[model samples]
Target: MSARTVLLPALAVLLLFALAGSLLIGPAGLSTPEALLGLFGSERGPAARVMREIRLPRSLLGAMIGASLGLAGAALQGYLRNPLAEPGLIGVSGAAALGAVLTLYTGLSAAFSLALPLGGIAGAMAAVVLVQLLAGREAGTITLILAGVAVTAFAAALTSLALNLAPSPFAALEIVFWLLGSLSDRSMEHVWLAAPFMVLGWLLLASTGRALDALTLGEEAASSLGFRLPAIRLRLVLGTAFCVGAATAVAGAIGFVGLVVPHLLRPLVGHRPGALLPASALGGAVLLLLADLVVRAIPTAQELKLGVVTALIGAPFFFALVLRTRRETA
Candidate 1:
């Protein structure tokens, strides 16, 4: 059997295990049988309520968001032909966060919860459009990345400014911690809000796998092979925008999952961008679910921020990657 066939199933199994682990671990600490009953039973009791209302949504969102990020990362890296490319590198997440922050500061979310994700989608679309404009039609990878950096910095500054000028202390504090990201207190509404966009993104990104594979030989070669570069780029940009935007709207700005998952799983998938897409998605879900489980398991007074945990793990890995790249260049 091929490594792709074996690895894909293994990753799927790992994701399922992590999801089961996510359902079992929580503040209430239900037993396995009890958790199962609560999850599947028709009862409206406390355990069922907890299971149906909270943990289920959280687990689903974690999987969806992680998959989106991972897949987006893979798509971006493949399209841009740069190993370091990721969704956040292009300001999609940052702009989406800014949109959510605007909704919060303006009290639009209080009026309507759906407004938050809508705002995020708008921000994300706008940012992508602006980046595209800045990069121009014929721009290269470096130009595109530089444009993204500029947009990211601007969006981040605006987010900070909103926090600084927050109407209340509690609001500021909430925004501060939220920027660190978490899956806590999430509900089915959040799952409903973000899942559609994330799934759409997955579809868009997944369909580009063959084109990305072709482009590995270079744009001219891929064009010669009958792949339309413009369509491929459009799908890549829109896919990342939708996935990262909705994710930030619901879960705030969780980072590193995208950047780490594809890099880790690439070799296992024989370094084929097409094969790496699904592998990265599953790996991302497993990694994020495990991280969420870790935060719940830790006996701290307050659960650690999901972003904090990821950064602590990812930063070192990032540094190691940098060193490796440096050595190769040397």
Candidate 2:
């Protein structure tokens, strides 16, 4: 049997288990049976309220956001033919975070519930445009990476400037915490706000799988295979913007899931970029859900931000990956 066939079902099952853990485990200390009862039972009780209101939304958002990051990462990597390509690495997530910060700075978020996400989406779109303009249509891998790095660095600088000039200490703190990323205190309203954009993004990214496979044989070959390069690029940019922007707006700047999940699962899927997308999505969900559980379970005085936890784990992996790449090239 192909590894893809075995890995997909395993990932799906693991995702279910992660979801269950997310739903059942919390600070409230509800027993497994009680949690299940609260989740499914029609009873209007405290357990049910906690299960339905708090944990459910948090779990769902984590899964969705994780999937978004993972799928976007895979798609970007495939399109660029670079394993290191990721939304966060490519400035998409940073730009989205800057947009969310602008909404906060302008107080538009307070005035309009949707303003924050819209702002993020706008920033993400701008980043895509900038990257495309800088890299050019026929840019090589080095050129693309340089463009992304330039964009990411600029976005981070602007974000830092905003924090430095924040109206008040309280506002600065809030922005800092948000940028660190967490799924805490999120409600169903956030889920509702982000879901449509994320779903649309998923559809757009998923549609590129066949094109990505063909492109593995090179751009000329893909064109000969009847895939329109310009259209594919458009879909990828739009899909990534939608996914990363909505996710960052709702859940702050969670990172690394995209960078890590695709690389980890790529070999499992026989290094086929087409096969990697779904697997990465499932793996991302499982990783994030479990990370959420860990943050909650940890006895820290304050809960660690989801982004911090991911960075902590992924930074080492990233270092190792860089070293491995260097060795292979050397």
lDDT of 2 at 128: 86
Per-model TM-score versus the true fold: 0.96, 0.93
Q: Per-residue lDDT of 53-131 in model 1, one digit per residue for the tens?
A: 9999999998898888899998888888877888898878999989888888888978987787788888898888988
Q: lDDT at 69 for candidate 2?
A: 90
lDDT score for candidate 2 against the true structure: 0.88
Residue pairs with backbone atoms closer than 3 Å in model 1 (clashes): none
For candidate 1, report its TM-score: 0.96
C-alpha lDDT of residue 113 in model 2: 78
